[model samples]
Target: MVRPLAVDVDGTLTRPKPDRGVDPRVFEALRAYSEEAPVVVATGKAFPYPVALCEFVGLPIRVVAENGGVVCIEQGDGDDPYGGGRFGDGVVYNGDREAADAVARAYEAEGHALGWGAVDLVNRWRETEIAVARDQPLAPLERVAAAHGQEVVDTGYAYHVKSPDVDKDIGLETAADRLGYGPGDFLAVGDSENDAEMFGVAGESWAVANADDAALSAADFVTDAAYADGFLEALERATE
Candidate 1:
């Protein structure tokens, strides 16, 4: 059997920001891949987005949303999330929401035009830290987050200002625990700096063609293709 696989959503499964939805091949590949083992969509897209996608696409896969803040277990035929198909994973915070919010407010007050993620209740009603879309230098912002026991890291598409207490690796570990697998039992794949956290933790890691330098450096392998296509190629190699 293939080991449990954790794939990032934005850059790995889908294209970058301003682009939405998974390619049909990616969606179908996920479904086919799931038959081999647990295939989880781990992303920074809040939580509801994954739920809606799964419901809309009829995917039976589990999800790790909000950059691993929570894991929605796959439904076992009887457990439904929205009264019909499936529900999202319960909220699991990697960082303190209160602390994260405090840090976010601090940045926004300083006149940082933050673009809040509307799908996950990032600003108004979130369980962990809020994700703000920003494309700028992060050194200064990093200091701001550090001051409050929080951190702001770029996920390629945005600067996630969050609780230093939790990260994607932490969330992945949590999911592994739930699935009764060890770090060496899976392959982590992605295409950004935030995804680097999964490298050392998983048995193997792959960086898509478009992965940033840091992500590529941390990966065990680098795919020739980019985005969803790269993911499928790497997955093929891994299972071989």
Candidate 2:
């Protein structure tokens, strides 16, 4: 059985779209899961974004942000109440800042606005990952990555330009380091292309019913429900 459950925020727990809120029931499920084992939220989202979600859940869990480039374990008010702030519990990997900047410039050159829409919140704070627009206009972005020897991936909400050497699985592995979790000890849940990396690496990965065909094909398990409901359903089974 998995010791820590790695969850994806947007399509997996949220409304399957960016800037959406999580259902209160979803938080309930997360709390329940936390009671059994460590819980980790792994997403392409930036820092405080993860912080915001943790605040909402009110359950301290580790955050693997920026598609695994940045990881933070919440500092509990006191008492080490949640078993957070442990594990490889810190920012594990960040791509070259120069590479991130160049990718940002490339997005602009391709006529994509860098500081607009869903990516606005993370634009300034993401020092290591180049997160720009979503998949609608991403072929050029991939080309830019190829030119720069970088990697570009879509999270359904946004396309991220990050270090090719680092992926969600890499970040997830860092979180698993202290907990005696090999990839075989993880049960990851996600619903987008960015999630594919973790799906392949985790012991067992579940793609929510709402996930695209590619994502579903990548996972070891596929849920019948969508969004947070799908996640909660999987949570129940994983714990059982």
Candidate 3:
């Protein structure tokens, strides 16, 4: 049996930003899962987001944040393991910093109207993808990249310009290895193009009903419900 579950945050376990929070019912489902098996909250969000979620849900599950840039296992010591010089057996790909910066600089050099929102540098098993959010349409970004023979993928939350090799899949695999688990030991779930990698890496992957077309297509299964409902469904399936 799979020993634990690794779940995405936005649009998987919870809604996206502005409304960035988990559904109460889904939180309850997570609580239920925690009693039976370890449930890891794996997300592209920064460390604080998952930390808040875990506190809100009152569960001490593990968290893999920043798209695997950071991983912290909840400890029974009532203190954060990541805070005390314990990297928690995770490897963060530091190479993304340079690659992500290059992409950002390229976008700026083209004079495309891009929002300089916080960029989350991701290194998923040596594959690099720079995640950025913008308030305007993405067509301009795409048009700019098309001229260079590159592509910009719309992940709902943001526009991502990646190496086409690195993605959530690599991140999940890295996380599994760090946690001493394997593909057969965890259930992966998400709702966007950024999540495609994670889905591909898991033995069984699930997409929320409201997930993007690409994500839904890539998933091994689709839940009948959306967001929190999807998480609850997956949790139930994992425990069973």
Candidate 4:
């Protein structure tokens, strides 16, 4: 059987630029691959984003969103699409949004804007983590997070302040169980600190060329290309 594939969004699937858009090349690649095996969208993004991405990309609705804070799989038949026949406690939530909210309040009290501006859409719908735009100062945010017993993770695209208890690997495990597999049966791919935990748990892992130090150190292989190009490279190597 083709090994299940778990991939990150943002830096791993998107172009690093003004728009940070998804590379169109990956859409076809993903759609084709999902036909043979499960394709999991694992991201630090809020829940709704990856779900929609899966729909558009023509992949299954297996998502690890909000880091490892939320896990959801589409189990309903087409007749009642998303009508709740899921597994592992049905939309498992490991994160504590209240804690993250407290951290955000403290960070703002210290004069930080969460870096996304007054109309912060990046975190508006986020259910589990406090997401701050990368432009914000890391030290102050980290300090505030630590003060509130939260940890900070840099996903390359942004800074996430969330419960240390949750990470992508945890979500992947949940996703795996629901899909009737294990972490070791999956091929993990990503490009940032948030992906480190996922790399550690997968039987094999790939860090895209643009991956941060944490992901690079944890991955079993590093692609030569960056962003979506690197992601495609990893997919090719996995087949080979």
Candidate 5:
């Protein structure tokens, strides 16, 4: 049986921007699952985002954020009492300032107008690469990548020029080691390229119907429904 279930927040739990909120049935099912097993909200969202989500759903569980680069455990009393213990401390992996800067410099050397933003980390995933385009156009960023023989990945909130080597799997492995959980013991669910690594590491993995082609191709199962409905279905399957 899966000891802990790791769930992605954005496309897996809720729809992307313009529509934010959990599905009612999905929330209810998650609450029910929390009563029987440990449900971990594993996403790119950091600190307060995970904390607030737990509060909103009334679930007491651990969270893996920043695409497994950060792991925080929620504790204390009240509906939203989090960030209290060392468990709230996150383990950052790929989204490091140094790495981001290095990539930015590479872009500059290529004569591409580069842009950068400090992602909340907690609200993003690793496979979700960032492009430094806060005040620049995406076309220039693409040109920079092309000049460098690289590719720009759209991470929703940011664009990332990334190497194929870096991804969420590395982050998830680090989190598993820190938390004392084996790869075989956990279940992962997601809906994007960023979620690919977590899906690979977990014993059981799932992708939502709305998942990108890459994510769907890698997932163990694809839900008939999308977003929260897919999450709920995956949870039920995992528990069973």
Candidate 6:
């Protein structure tokens, strides 16, 4: 069987900002690959987003959402998330949402907006961790988050404030266990700092050409292309 594929969303599957959505060129290849091995779409995105992506991408709903705060692996036949599915190991949660929220509150009290503005859907469904818009001043948010016993992580798209104990690796560990595999059995690919922890755990890891410093440092290899092209390149290399 093919090794499990753990991939990021934003900059890994899609193009950078000013461009959006997973590139159509990857759809066929990704779906084909998923037929041979589980494709875990891991990201700092909220749970629903990745779940929906899995649905539309024609892959089973295996995702590490909210930067490792939420993990869902489709095992057995029950598809309802709120019903029998929650009874077993179908879903798992980590991180401290309350602590992260406190950081957001304190940061706003210091006269800084959360930066996404009102009706910010980016974080509307996020169940764990706090995602601040990347345009916000990072240093001040970092200071406020630290005071509240939280840490800030830059994923290029946003600044995530979360518990130091939680990260993508933690999420992957949960996923791997539930799927009857180990962390080292997976091949990971991504392009941001949020993916750094995951890169460190996978048996093999690739940072896209445009990856941030953290991811580049953590990954075992770096693809020659950026964005979705880099993802395709990594996928090809893995299967080759």
Poorly placed runs, candidate 4 (over 4 Å): 76-88
Computed on alpha carbons, the lDDT of every model, listed in order, comes to 0.74, 0.76, 0.66, 0.89, 0.65, 0.87
* Number of the top-ranking candidate, with lDDT as the measure: 4
Q: Across residues 18-98, which tens digit of lDDT does each residue of candidate 2 receive?
A: 447776778877777777767788888876787678767766747788888887654433246445444334565655657
Model 3 Cα shift for residue 204 (angstroms)? 1.4
Show the colliding residue pairs in model 3.
127-166, 169-197, 169-198
Query: Per-candidate TM vs. native?
Result: 0.85, 0.86, 0.75, 0.94, 0.71, 0.94
User: Model 6 misses residue 133 by how many Å?
Assistant: 0.9
Please give the range of 10 consecutive residues that has the lowest summed lDDT in model 4: 75-84
Ten contiguous residues minimizing lDDT sum, candidate 5: 120-129
Q: Candidate 3: TM-score?
A: 0.75
Residue 56, candidate 4: Cα error in Å is 1.2
- Per-prediction tally of clashes: 3, 0, 3, 0, 14, 0
Candidate 6 lDDT trough over 10 residues, lowest sum: 76-85
lDDT at 165, model 2? 84
Q: Candidates sorted by lDDT, descending order? A: 4, 6, 2, 1, 3, 5
Q: Cα deviation in Å at residue 185, candidate 5? A: 1.2
Residue 221 C-alpha lDDT in model 6: 96
Name the Cα RMSD for model 2.
3.2
Query: Could you give me the TM-score of model 5 versus the true structure?
Result: 0.71
- Candidate 4, residues 1-240, lDDT tens digits: the string is 679899999888898756589999999988888877888899999999998998787666889999999998764322344455544366888899999999999888888888887798888989988899888899999998998889999887789999988999999999998888899999999999999999999999999998999999999999999999999999999888
